[model samples]
Target: MGLSNWPDICLGSLTPLLPEDFPIDEDHEFKPDNFYFLKGCVHFKNTAQILDMTNKVKKSRWRDFSQSFLRDVDNAAKKADEEQEKPKYEIKSCGEMMRTIKTMVDGQKGEKICELSMTFVSFDSSMVRFPDKEHSRHPLEICPVEAGSENKHECFVRHSIPYFWDMSSQFGTLYKCLNQKRVKIASICAFGFGKDAVLAIEGDQLDDVCALSTCIILLNGRDAMDH
Candidate 1:
C-alpha cells in the first residue's frame, strides 16, 4: 500500500511455522494460500494484536481494508514457499524444474524411467508483487480435496503434487485496488508452463512411459472477477 504505516506484505517471504496444509498436486507444488492454509500454519507471531486490530476496523475502513489485504499477502507468500518445495521429473519450465527434468530426460545420462504416480495434494495462488513496493510475500495454501488439484495422478487422491502461482503475474494489472500493471502475457505464460507437467521421454519411448499433463487454460482473475 502507498500508506507507510500499514504492514508490508510479500508473496514469498514467510518462514513457515508448521508443515504446509496442502500436499502436492498433479504437477507437485506446495499450494499454501488455500483456505486450509491458516488451518495448517501457525498463526502470525502477533496473533492477538492482529486480531484486535481487525476487530477495531470496519469494511469501509482503509486501514482495515489494507490490513486485510496485507494479511492475504502474508498468507500468499507463505503458500508460495510451500509450493516451491516439490518438483515432478515429468514437469518442465524455466530454470529449476526445467533443469531438473533436463537431467532426467537427456538420455545421454541414461536415467531410469520409473513409473511415477502423483496424487492431487494442493494448489493455490500467491498475491501480486509490485515492483514499486518492497512488500513482504506470503502464499495461500489450497488443498486439492477442496477444489481442482491441477494434477493427473492425485487430482482427487490425497497424495497428489502441489502447485503455486503468483497472482500478480496472472492478474497484477487488473486488480485495481492493488494498482498494478495490466495482464502481463509473458508472466502469465511463464506461470502457465510453470504449473504444467511436461513428460519428456527419449525418442520412441512415449509408449514406454504412460504419463499425462493437465492444466486448465482458464482466463486470469479478471475472468473470475467478471463473474
Candidate 2:
C-alpha cells in the first residue's frame, strides 16, 4: 500500500497500579512521580511494509468477530445434519488459511521491504504443530476467558504469530490503559529460524503501540556445537 493509503495509528496509554494494589518496599520512601507511570509505542519504518500476525485466539473463545475466511468455515460447521440437507463442509486446512492471510498482506506491499511472517500456537488449542520450513508454532495452555477479561475485546488481534520451531522463547506481554481501563494490547517474543534470530509481536494494533527498545542478535550455532 502507498503512504497515502496507510491508516493512521495512535499510541494507547499504560495504566498505573494503586499503591495499595501493588507491592512496594515499606522501608523506602515511595517516589510517586518516578514510579507511578510508564509509556511506550511502536512504529514501522517508512521504507518497510510490516505484516504482523499474532495468535490471540482462545480455544474455548466464543466466536466473536466474523472475518472473511473464518466465517466460511464457521458457517459450514453450523449447517443441518441430514446428508441432503447438510451443507458441503470442505474443511479449510490450516495451511490454506495461512495462505489467505499471506495473500492479503502481500498484495498490499508492491515491493519486498520485509516479507516476514510470524505465526504462533493458539492458546488452549489441542492441535499439534507439524514441522514447517517457514512458520513457528507454540502451544499455549488453555486459559479461562475470565482469567483476564477486563480489557476490551477489540484490544487484541486474533491472528497467530508465524514463527517456526527454531526460535527462542523470550516473550512477554504489553499493557495499556484505554478509556480509563487497563488492558494488555501487545506482546513481544523471539524465534530461532535455524541459526538466525527473529522477533515476533502480538497485539490488537501494532502500528499505534510504542517501541521502548528493539535489538536483533544473530547467534553462531557452530561455537555451541563445539562446546
Candidate number achieving the greatest TM-score relative to the actual structure:
2
lDDT of residue 75 for candidate 1? 51
Residue runs of model 2 more than 4 Å from their true location after superposition: 1-107, 111-170, 179-181, 193-227
TM-score of every model versus the real structure:
0.16, 0.21
Say what the RMSD of model 1 is: 22.3
lDDT over C-alpha atoms for residue 143 of model 1: 19
Tens-place lDDT per residue, model 2, 1-227, is 11233122211224312212222223432111100001011111111112221222222322222243233323332332222332111111112222111111122333211122212222221121213322212321111121133321112111221111111223333333333333333333322222211122232233221111111101111112221
Candidate RMSDs in order? 22.3, 19.2
